[model samples]
Target: MRLSIIRDAFDLVTKTQNLSSSKTDEVIDQIGLEIEIALGKMHNTEPGVDCKDVLNELMRNLLRIAPLSQMEGIQNELNVPLCEYKKILEKYFNPDISKAYRNFDIDTHTLNQIISKHFYREGLFDVGDHFVSVLGEPESAAIMKSPFLEMYQMLEAMKDRNLEPALNWAATNSDKLAQSKSDIVLKLHSMQFLKILQNGSIVETIDYGRTYLSPFTSTHKDHIQMLMACLMWIGKLDQSPYKALLLPSNWERLAEELKRQFCNLLGESYNSPLSVTLAAGVQVLPTILKFTNILVKKRQSMNHLPVPIDLGCEFQFHPIFVCPVSKYPATEDNPPMFAACGDVFCKQSILMMTRNGTRVFQCPYCPLDIDAAECRQLHF
Candidate 1:
């Protein structure tokens, strides 16, 4: 009888459409129930039994029956609000605000118009530019066929001004109906990004790379756009990876600007976590240098010189350390120079790019760069 129940649960999961939400929940719940019963049977078979063996057996069975979860794809899906996400997306395909309002609030049509107008004309493009970044193109046909696309169709109704159809679609696919929500939550951490410790969001940025593991559109434009969004967000918050903020300027000025912005954001209340450690030769600078050193050391293909030990030592001894002094000039006109438009990129970065046969140096911070041929002509 127990085996029959387990088999039935398996069949239910197997028969459901890949995009169906109901089957995801049913499969998980039924598997959980069977595991509990299996464990119960083991308990009843022996008086005061050591439950470890039974528990392990139950766990194995549960693992064997668990449905495949698109963990990364699901994580990307839940990161943004549904309506706002759909609305922002319309801008990329075209400038139409009609799609933006298709799912306008049934209870607040006027409000939906206001929100759509505000975003579509004002900030939706920027939002879509950023949003498409958070979740790349769907990885599977299952995802393209999922309720997410249904949400997109509902968005289409706004373009047609068909409020009834839009609202009906939204109603049928309510937020509460996302049965895979729990499975997604298990794999992601949801802390307010702004409220984390100073370095928190920087760490969160690493997970952005993981989204690529899911099969998505493999376009260079998409990758560059996603990187730009991450850099912009970090730059706005006065965050680190100092190289990311270089604009069309000298290294000194760029470094100074970043330092100023960081100080402004950190403010007086920041209590100088670095200073306290410096007074006693124990603190923030050393820890940061260690991290950077490890990252730098791990690169196998880098052609640029390493950061000097003296600099790391200085940071260790001092309470606070800012940008490194520029030892190299800022343009291709200078031998061993690398220019990206408004600013000179790191020598190491230039060396690496050159090694890869890349010629045109587009500065990450500002829009300044000669074409590959121009840069080559300038190269000594």
Candidate 2:
């Protein structure tokens, strides 16, 4: 809406300029013609043609049509649209984000360290170093250097279509990978086999598959079979049934998987904290701004917002349990309890239902009867 108003103002100014220029030209032409006619009349009569009266008449006509007063009027007309545009901007433009900042009270030093560490984790070594130097904490930069550096080096190798570094890293952390039940190693080997099939000889491809893929056959039998079938279409693999193996998306997926495994080994999250926070903010900022506007209009204090803001399931990182019996959210103090009959309720609610001089409480969801003492706390 603001843009539309500004565009209209611009168009009006342009039209006003064109109209003023044309009117000024017309006034000048009329004055010139009057002078020419007056001179012609006096040209054959006298030596000194005193055309003062004619000149005064022309000046009066020019002033009446396109004077300095009219220029001021035109400027006033342009100012109306411009003022309207400014008013619209002031109405909708919210530059105050202090409401959002009011909730956070992080330590300055901690915030700086976190930012510097984030820079290092993102492979901005020089930026991290400069930040550390500015903060007079060179040791922070030194402490954070090695781990992310190795991770990025492995990623760089993968980008270059060289998987040796990643493969070696995976082999070195095989035990931890197995404990996590991650299939990254097998997926990496599969990508390696596909690379060989795309560029190397059939003999070399078969050799590579046998050496790398055989270990994963027990868990990924069908995938291995499909990969081996690609060998039949050696040179014409694009038309083969297993052609999806050659897709660039496969490499991208492998890269993501490798990064996930790498972060898991380092006891870090798969996604950067800053990225997750920004994404969550993008999801919730609209609702927050709307609420803020409402509070402002109502002339109410916004210090406490009791209303819930739903940001959808995507932003819900952890499980949330609501008790069906109590119709309330389950918290640590009153957790969800699972009964022997497969029905769940808040602990306090279940205890209340069974405390009427009876040991057994009929399950609300099922026909089975169960004792409240038999209930167990359920964890998400």
Candidate 3:
């Protein structure tokens, strides 16, 4: 309903503006025609043209039309809908987001770094530089900006179907990627091979695939076969069974994967850490405000949320382990531990069962006896 009101308001404004513009144009055309007729009559005179008569007639024509009043009326018409639109917007949106804010524990330097790095990550190099310069710590932020700058450059190159930069970066870090079980290098080579196949001879395509795409055959045999099968279709690969692989979406996915791998190589996450935090915070801020307004009105600190807030899966980095026995989430100080009997319990919970590691006890889920010393720490 609010958006419908806004649309209606803007529609009225546009209609009024068009009408006013048409009216003004018609009036101006009339005035111009009258002045031209007057000038023509004055110019065709047998004797000296009466300049005073022409000036008087032009003045009279302009006054009779009252162009200024008509313009003022048009201006008023435009302003009417504009004023109402502003009021409607202010009424419906209630955009005072400051109402949701609370002071949280973060130092000035940390905040500056986050803001500066976000600007750089977004490819706003000038903004980031100006910000860091004002902060008088430009040298500190220089190191963090270069990696993201290169990643964006590669992304831009890929936009133009140029893959050399990305391919070189992938080859340089192939060892790390292989250790992580990534086949993006092979995928890049396959894309390059496909490009060759699209415009070159079948023999040239085969030769390129042999030189570049052959190395991934051991691990990516099906993928390699798919590339080789394109040889049969050659210029008409769009009709082949592998046509789905020829989509622009394939390039988009490859670009995203390249960015992820690029960040990994830099020992950073695919998403900016500051972006993730703010995104998660945006989700939880409303609940925080609700509590602040009603339940926790006099709270001194917002270091920890007064209640649990479930954010979207994008914010979840790993599975949350809750101690089954205590029915509480396991924290780093009380991390979950795996028992030998294939059961898991929090370290504190396991300590309680084993009497602080002084005695052997039966597992809660199974009948097997277990000792706390035998329980291994679970990384997750």
Candidate 4:
């Protein structure tokens, strides 16, 4: 709808320009014709015709056909449509978004540091260094350089189909990966085996498998069997039963998995912090804008927004519990408690119903009756 309005305004401007051009041409043609006829009459009548009188007559004809006042009137009339268009647009204008930040308590220095770190995480080291230096904090650049630099180097190597750096990193962090139950090392080894099968001799491929693929056989037997089968069609693996093993997507998947595991080992999220925050903000901006409009209409302070904007499951990184009976959300202090029958309620509400843990109560959402002591605190 907004685009349509803008397009209509643009079309109107174009139409006005065309009309003005056509009107100007018409006036000029009329004046030219009148002057031509007057010139012919003067030439036929006498050779010594009064030039001043002809000029005056020509000016009068030009003024009558396209007067200055008439041109001004056309311009003024064209503005009327533009003014109406402006009014139409004003009706749909959103309230000033700056009003939403009237009470923001952000620290500029902290924000700058975050931005610098975000740039560093994205492998923009020069840009990050320049920012830190401009902010007069050269010492802080040391802290930002190491982790992301190593990560970026690993990613670069993976991009070139070189898994040596990634494999080394994975091997060094084996215990952490095992604790986290990550299969990134196995996946990387599989990728290495595929690379060998593609470019190396059959003997070399078998040797590579024995060294790397054997350990993962118990956990990934089917995949190891497929890799072993690829050796049969050494010269033509694309036509083998394990043809899917030669796909470029395997390398891509391995790279992604490697990055995820690397970040996991460092206790960082798989996605960059900046990306997650931006995605969440983009998802919630519309609801926030609508709520801001409501607050304006109600003449209320926009300092606090209504709870539970519902940005959908993707943006819900953490768990939220709402009491079925009270219809109120659970907090850390008063967490949701689950009954033996699998019903959940806020601690305060359940305590009230159980008479301060001195009696039993029926599950509000089920047929099971149980003592308050049986209700366990649920954690998300």
* Candidate 4 residue-wise lDDT, 220-246, digit = tens: 899899889888888888887778877
Q: Write the per-residue lDDT of candidate 2 for residues 1-380, one digit (tens) a residue.
A: 54586677667667766776676677678767776776775565465656676566656866776688876776676577667666665554455655554465779988787788788778898898898999998877787777888888988898888999999998999999999999998988888888888884999999999998998889899989999988898888889887877788887888888878888888878777777778887666555676777887899666644355566886677877777776667899999998898878899898789778887988878889888778899998
Residue-by-residue lDDT tens digits, candidate 1, 1-380:
53465455445444442434554566678787987797678758777766787788787877666634544344334433343334444422233323212232355544333333233322244553343344442232232233333434434543443334433432343343234221111111111122222244665554543432122234244533444344455635445343333232433342233233322332321123333334433332343344444655886432332443244453453232111333443343333333435343445555554565767655556666544443322232
Q: In terms of lDDT, which candidate is stronger, 3 or 4?
A: 3
- Of 3 and 4, the candidate ranking higher by TM-score: 4
Alpha-carbon local distance difference test for all models: 0.40, 0.79, 0.83, 0.80
Q: Which residue runs of candidate 1 sit more than 4 Å off their true CA positions?
A: 1-18, 47-49, 67-88, 92-380
**How much does each candidate deviate from the true structure in C-alpha RMSD?**
30.6, 9.1, 9.5, 7.9
TM-score of 1: 0.17
Question: How do all models score by TM-score?
Answer: 0.17, 0.62, 0.62, 0.65
- Of 2 and 3, the candidate ranking higher by lDDT: 3
Q: Each model's number of backbone clashes?
A: 10, 0, 0, 0
What's the best-to-worst order under lDDT?
3, 4, 2, 1
Q: Per-residue error at 296 for model 4, in Å? A: 1.7
Candidate 3 lDDT over residue span 20-118, tens digit each? 889888888988988898888878866766878788988999888756787798889999998999898776554666766667687999889888988
Superposition error at 376 for model 1 (Å): 64
Worst 10 residues of 2 by lDDT: 93-102
Which ten-residue region of model 4 has the weakest summed lDDT?
91-100
| lDDT of candidate 4 at residue 147, scale 0 to 100 | 83
Q: Judged by TM-score relative to the true structure, which candidate is superior, 1 or 2?
A: 2
Cα deviation of 271, candidate 2, in Å: 1.7
